[model samples]
Target: MAANDFYKTPSDAVTAVNSIYFLLNAGSNAVQTPYNTLFNTGMNFMGDDENPGPGATNPDVRSQSVLGHASTGLRVLQIWQQHYSGIKKANIAIEKIPGIDFGANTKLRERLIGEAKFLRALYYFNLVRLYGGVPLILKDLSTLEEAHSKPRRNTVQEVYAQIEKDLIEASTVLDPIAGGADAGRATAGAAKALLAKVYLTQRKWENAILKANEVITGPYGYNLVQNYAEVFLPIYKNGPEHIFSAQFKSVSQGQGNNQAPRSVLTGVPGIVGSYADQVVFYSVPDATKPGGVDKFFSVYKLYSKKDKRRDVTFVTKFKSPTNGNWYGRLNDPAIPGDSVPFFNKYWDPANVSNLAESGANVPIIRFSEVLLILAEAENELNGPTGIAYTNINKVRRRAGLDDLTEGLSQHQFRDSLYLERRLEFVFEYQRWFDLIRERDAAGNGILESSLHKVGKTNASAKHYLFPIPQQEIDLNPNLEQNPGWL
Candidate 1:
C-alpha cells in the first residue's frame, strides 16, 4: 500500500509507527546495509574508555579504536543511509497522520503524530551528533525531482531547534505511560529526557534542568531499580528504570534484530569455549561484538569494593566449559587467555540456543541517566546544592557507594558528575559523544582531555564531528562536508 494508505486506519498508523523502529534493528535484510552495529561501534568503542579486545585484528574493528575509518567505508555510509531512510518513514507518518480524523478515537491521531515526531527527532539527533549539521528533511517528498534537488545542510543550531520543537510537541501529546507490546514505545518522559540531553549538549542548563526534572518527577513515576543488573535482564526490558529502548526479541536470523550480534562473544577462543558451537549464525553477523572487544579502563577499575554495580557491568573472569579452566585474569599478560573482562550488561544465556542473536534490548535511555542529568544540570545552574548531591547520591547509593562529598567547588562537582556518568553509563554509546560535545572557556571540549589521557591521540579537533559520508555529498551536491574533512 502507498504511504498515505497506511495512515488512513488506526491499525495502519500503529504499523507505520512501528516501521520507524525497524531501521534501528535493521541488519542484513536484503538491502545490503549494516547500521546499528556501525553506529554503536563508532560512538561507544571508538573512544578511550573502550578499545579492541586483546588480539583483535578486524580492520573495521581496529579502525574505530584507532579513528581511521574513511567516509566511504561501509560503517560510515550505512549509518548515513539508515538514519535518512528512517527519517523518510517518519516524515511520511508525520505528514499523513495529522489530518486524518480518527472518529471517536481522535486521541489516537495525536499519539501517533507524537510518536512519529519523537522518532524523527531521534533520527535527527543521531545525525547531528555524529555528523554535525545534516540536511533537515522534514516533509515527505512528492516526486523524484524534489528528492534529487535537496537543500543544503542546515546549521547545527537550526537542526537542534527543530529537534527541540518536535520533542517539546511530542512531550505534550504522548501519553505518560505505555505497557504490554507497547511498552517499548515512546512516552512523554522519553521525549522530555531526550530534549533535556539536547539542552545539556547546547549548554542550556536551565532548560535541561527543567526537562530532566519532569522526567524524574513527572507522571511516569520513573525510579532507579534497586539492583543494577536488573536493568538489562530480558524480564526487565521495559522496567521502571528503562525510559526507552530499541526492542529486540530473539528469533531466526533474517527475522531477528541486528544489534544482537553486537552483544555476543561466541567466536573468541578461550573466552567462549569452542566458540563456533556457542553461537549460531544465520544472516550476516559481524565478526566481533562491539562490547566484547571493548577493554575496560580505570573508570571501571575505580569502583570501590563495596559498589554493587561493578559485577553487573563486567566480568573479570569466566570458566571455560571445555577445560573447566578459568580465563580473564586482569593485568597478567603471562596468562594463557584474554584477561580483559567482557561487558556483561547485554549477556543472555538464552542466546546460546537462538544463535548469536541476543534478546537484550539496547538501551537508548534509562532513568539512571535522567538522575545524573539532573545532578549535572543542578550543579551547573547553581553550584553544588542539596538537590544536586541528593540526585547524584541516589545513583551512588544504588551502587553501594556512599554519598558524594559535600562543599565541593563547581569545578570539582562538574568533574565528579562526569566521573559518575562515565562509570554508570559505560558501553551504552555515550563516551565519545560526551568528549566532543560542548566547548570550554578556552574553546576546547570539556572531555577532550580525558580522551587524550587514555591515548586517543587521533581524537583531535577534526574528529569532534565525523565527516559527512562521501556518498551523501555525491548524491546531493548541496550537502557540504565538515571542515578538515575536505
Candidate 2:
C-alpha cells in the first residue's frame, strides 16, 4: 500500500525526518531547572542549598535543593541523554542522506542537511560547555554493540573544533532566511551566529566580533525591532529581529509550549500567602522577588524606569488592563491584597491550558543577544571607545534609553555593559554568562560589594565548567572528571 511505502522509504518519511531534529528541542520535565536563578528571581537557593528544583508541582522529580538526590541525578542524565539523542539523530540524517534520499530537490536536501548540522553542533556545544570535553560521537549508531563502545568523552579542544566544523558546514549549506513553510528551519545566519558564540566562549575576540558583525550587517533577514516589546510579541512570532528562536505553534497544545507560560499561569489572581509575606506585587521583581519575602520592588521600578525594554518585556501595573498605575508588591499574602502585581510578560492569558502547557516559545537566541555579545566582545578586545559604545547604545536605544558616552573608562565601560546586559536580558539565562565572562585571564569574577546584593558569587576554575556527572565518570574509566568534584 502507499502508506506502507511511505513508512518503508526513508525518502517519504517526512515525519521521521522532522523528528530527528526535534529531539534537541523537545521540552522535558528535567530537574534542577533554571527556575531557581533564571526563571525565578525571588527565591534565594544557591551555594548553600545543593538541590535546586523540588518541583513546586511534581513530587517524584522533586529534589530538596538539588543537593545530592538520586532523581536529580536522573534529571541531569536526562538532559545529557536527550540532547545526545538529538545529536545522534542529526548525525544519522547526515549519513543516510546520500543513500536513502529525499527526492532530487537539491535545495531541499541541502537545507535539511544544513539544519541537521546546525542542531548537531548546538547539542554538542551545550554538552561540551556543561561537561568540558565530551566524547564526540559523529557517526550514527546502528547496532547495540556500536552504541555501547562508541560513546567516549572527547577532549575540550576536539569538541570545540567539531562544533566549529559543523557550524561552518551548516553556514555554507543554509539559506540566510527560511521562508514560506520553512521559516523555522535553521539558516546560514543562525549557523554563523552560533559560531560567533562558540568563538566568544573560546576567547577568540576578533573572530567573535567579525562573525557577529557579519550577521548584523549581512542579509539573513535580521534587524532590530523598532520597539523592544515587538521583539517578543507572540502575535508576530519570530519577529523581524529574531535570528533564531525556539518556534512553538499550538494545534490545541502540541509541541513548542514550554515553561514560558508559567509567568502568567502561575500568576493567576491569588494571594501570595505561603508566607505571611503578602507582597501582592503588580510589577516585575528586581533583586528581591516582588511577591516573596526578601523581595524588593523599589529596585525594579528604579532600574526599569529608564530601561527601554521595561514596559515591553513586562506587564507592570502601569501597563495592566486596569488603572495602568504602578502598584508595588503587596506585603500580605492572606488577602488577595489591594495592590497585587503580576508578570504578564511570558504568558498569553488567553491560553486556557494547564500551568505547564503554555505555548510561548522561549527566545533562547535572538539578534538582541548577539548585539550585546558584540558590544561586550568589542569592549574586551578594543577597550572602552565610541565604536563599541555604538553597539551598546543600539541596544539601549531600543529600550527607550540613551547611550553611555559618559562612562568611558575601561573599568566603567565593562561595568556598564555587563549591567546593561543583566538588566535588559533578565531571566533569560544571561546572568550566569555575565558572571562567567567577567573572569579575567587570571580567572577572577568577584562582585564588588555594591553588586553582591543581587547574588554574590565568586568564580573559580571549578565553576568555569560544571563537573562531569559522577555516574558517567564511574562507568567510563576514560572519562576524567573536572576539578572540585568528589
- Candidate 2 per-residue lDDT over residues 84-187, each given as its tens digit: 67777787777665454556566767767777888888878877765678889888776668757726677889999999999999999899887777766788
Cα displacement (Å) at residue 300, model 1 = 3.1
Q: Give the Cα lDDT of each candidate.
A: 0.73, 0.59
Clashing residue pairs in all predictions, respectively, total 0, 22
Find the candidate with the highest lDDT and give its number.
1
State TM-scores per candidate: 0.88, 0.78
* Local lDDT at 145 for model 2: 88
lDDT of 1: 0.73
Stretches of candidate 1 off by over 4 Å are: 28-35, 54-58, 99-101, 252-299, 319-338, 353-355, 438-443
Model 2 worst lDDT run, 10 consecutive residues = 271-280
lDDT for position 349 in model 2 = 44
